[model samples]
Target chain A: MPKILIVDDDPNIRQYLAALFEDHGYLTVVARDVAEALQTAQDERPDLITLDLDLPGEWGPRFYRALSQEPELKSTPIIVISAMPGSRYAIGNAVASFTKPFDREELLKTVGETLDL
Target chain B: MAKTVLLLEADSSHADALKIYLGRKQAEVHVAATDEKARGLLASRDFDILLGNPYGFGEACPGEVKRHKLANPLLQVIIFCPRALMDQAMDDFGPLAANYLDLPLNSKALGLALDHAEKCIATEKKLAAYSQRLSDLHDAQSLYQQLFNEVPCYITVQNKDLRITDTNAKFKRDFGHEVGGFCYEIYKHRSSPCPECPVAKTFYDGGSHGTEEVVTSKAGKQYNVITQTAPIKDENGQITQVMEMSTNITQIRQLQDHLSSLGLMLGSMSHGIKGMLTALDGSIYQLETGLQKEDRTRMAAACEQIKEMTERIKKMVLDILYYAKSRELQYALTDVRELAETVVSMISPQARHKGINLVTELEKDLGIIEMDPNWMQAALINFLDNAVDACLFDPKEKEHRVVFRVSPRDPETVCFVIEDNGTGMDRQTRETLFTLFFSSKGSQGTGLGLFIANHVVQQHGGSITIRSELGEGSRFEVCLPRVKTDHARLNAVPQPHQNVAF
Candidate 1:
């Protein structure tokens, strides 16, 4: 099963995303901020990362930049989910972007296409 | 222009010859043989010249003509008399007579005398017209000067050098009579001229220009003013100076700032609301899957998430509603002791959860006070909650405690003081604590609680006194009068926004 990492400060969002991915036969991990996201990404080596822009500490854009700086994590696929508008260009290298109250089926399709599952 | 001549010679033959000679020179001569006829002619019609021998009537003739001449300054008199009395004519008339001619008048001399008298008449008329014009100009200039001084706005006329050439009464009243001072120096206290100056723009284009600026008065009071400039031009249409008028719009701008800040808050809050809505969707998703998959743990967790999110949304909505309106205080007679106890009870549980000790000094028989119980309780709770947060922010390993004290300051007023041993705010935060959207807790604070609390307390004729240090702690004392009409109680209120030095 492909593994997914969910990055959001809100625990409810983390729980929901984890359950959604796990139910689709993908193993899941969660982190509340950029530091934890980086730590979990290094350890879990997830096939995909779902990032939220508005984090408590470092923002999602910083996490995306940090990914590029790490040679091993440079190829990780990032899907940006944010409540703030103009987040599409905030992380230009992300595979897809969705604002809050996102359509569930559409997000799942984009994930499947990015992972080619 | 025909000159009317009055011939008072007392010689009929001489009069006929004089009238004929004068008529040839465009002089309409009227014969006045006696003083009575001369006075009648002078009174009935305006005559340009009086040609007569004053000695013909002895002393009566010259004195009457002198009196008439004083009354009619433009009326010229030519005296013709017997050779013996020509000296007497000169003595009586003085320089007031136009000329003196001996009797048996030589036609050439008489003609010359009339010509000379006509010349005097024209010169005096020209002088009188000039004096009238000069007086009119003086009146007009003074009237305009009065208008300039009476204008309500601050007005300054600046020359090309940007030096004030003139200032109106209102300007002198506020900024002092700063004529010959540099515009920037007097108005803005700047060593150099302001950039993008409207006065300079007006002088360049000969067009009126306007800008809004914050200016300080001579008394050191600040004002928001809308300044406009117009070119003062010479007759050749060259812009020689610029007249700058500044209308004080401080009150209007202050009101607009308040309203705009409210709009700004709403705009910022919308983003937070969107995120909350998404979180709500996530909770709903969890609930739906839990029900579909027969998962009891997920269902219970989903229920708790929904409840918490609902509470957050409800609070935000209420905050928006409360902030949008300047609500009137709904006063009720309520026990003051119970009110303090109720607020302490709410803060006690949170204090314990955070390992912060809660201390209360609730005095006995505090008595009843008339106030809006709903908002007043919220205000007291807000202060206690802030005390807790201040303690939480202090990461130093030490005992943390919050003290809530309620007491009656006097017969007509009550006090609620909340003090905390926590990471207190600096002077900047303390000064702007009650202003719109001023938050010290970063993302954790909504910035609305203290502002709303301050407003509610003020509406109920209360005041908040703040005293805080950088690392020591903060103390917020709220003193509210027993009644809303307690205007005299303000004299007893403490000095506000006291910051600790160092």
Candidate 2:
């Protein structure tokens, strides 16, 4: 099964995405903060990562740096989710970008199409 | 205003001599040689002091002195007696006599007693007048309170510390249940005092101030209150208390909001439509020119753009109609979970295109919340739109998502929480979020979304709250009561409003 990693401080969002990915026949790992996301990346070596630009403590560039340094997860596709559609970080150098309250089908399609599912 | 002295001595020789001496000292002196004659004279005039001999006709004359006192209670009576009779007179007359002179009165002692008697008389007269005036003032104060309490405005008195000292009848009736409560707690519905208080300024300056403020009741209903506070002062010009009159202006504020919103709606619709028309016209011109030149590709593109612009205009018109009638919410019993799902589904496509997650956690077997589905959808869409706007940025944050969760809070109410992991609002933005005509989006915002949402929620006996922190994200919570309101019945005939996603 394809492995997907979800990073978000909100437990509800993290749990919901995990359930969504698991239901769709994928192995899902959820991380509530940036530190946890880095640890999960090292251990699980997920196929793709979904990252929230806003994590609890170490947010924005700090989390991005942590993700870029992981040798095992360096080649893995990362999708950035943001509420601000016009923000500088929404789509800069990310594999895929989505706005909050995203369309479920399009998100799945992007993930499926990106991985050639 | 001339000082006068009346000597009531029955001894003819003593009376004549005393009269000559007092007259020489610039005092008008009248001598009566008999007690009966003196009593008759006293009945008709105002006297500064009355000098009398207690041994009138040698009849153990205590009765005559007492009678004189009864006639004029404030009369200063100085007894003149020979040294032999001085002790007897004092014992018999009690102390009604202010002082005594023995034998042949020394002119110096007599003159001093007369001056003392004049001062005593003046003080007594002034005190009597003052007492009468005070009684009259009390009557006037009671009458004024009656008039003040009868007015409709809420009146309250507070100390410099904002402690409620007293409240009038109207204030009592309006907020009597909250007596002895902190002024801010009772009036502003705040857990603590307001940060910026006009009452504080008024206290500092000893001046009157008027301002409009929003106050919340214990029941959580908000009121637009116009308050005026004036300093209550003492004779020394020190502010002892503050008199506050607050008038409920909630309805007036709502009307002003409605009118301004109506104006904004007209203004934006005209502006949007005009721009849409101009674009449509330009596209038409392009298509006509392309067709004339036999360029089929350009003509097709122009036609497509025109169609899109027209569709956009149509949507704008529908939004205006939806909000214009939001005051009258027609509602019915609707499944809360189903409604949330439907809204999520409708907005999912836009989210999917933007690559954001759309999710809903609807509790199963939840009872229905009565609300106007079309209006409610418009209101919810406002939150969804804000959520969408918060996440619409260049770097697609992977965890950018909005969640619509509904759970039964109680048998009579359902909790609907729509939280977005979008850019959360700051304190100031949250404060003015739902106020009519207050928008932070500048020209891009019509300021109608939250206002309309607030109105719709209020109509359905529900409440909407926004929780946000800067750079983190924002959450919108709406709690709807399960009991069907009259508004629900009116809106229940749901012909889906045009452009309403849910």
lDDT of 2 by residue, B241-299 (tens): 88888898876676666557677767654433433453565466557667777889867
RMSD of each candidate relative to the true structure: 8.1, 14.4
By DockQ, who's the top model here?
Answer: 1
Local distance difference test values of all predictions, in order: 0.83, 0.71
For residue B384, what is the lDDT in candidate 2? 84
Error of 2 at A26 (Å): 48
Q: Score the docking of each candidate (DockQ).
A: 0.43, 0.02
Tens digits of per-residue lDDT, candidate 1, A27-80, equal 999987788899999999999999998775357788999889999998999999
Instruction: Give the TM-score of each candidate.
Output: 0.68, 0.48
Model 1, range B248-312, lDDT digits (tens) per residue? 99767755665676788887776667767877888898899999999999989889879767866
Q: Counting only residues 3 or more apart in sequence or on different chains, how many pairs clash (N, Cα, C under 3 Å) in candidate 2?
A: 44
Q: What tier of docking accuracy does candidate 2 attain? A: incorrect
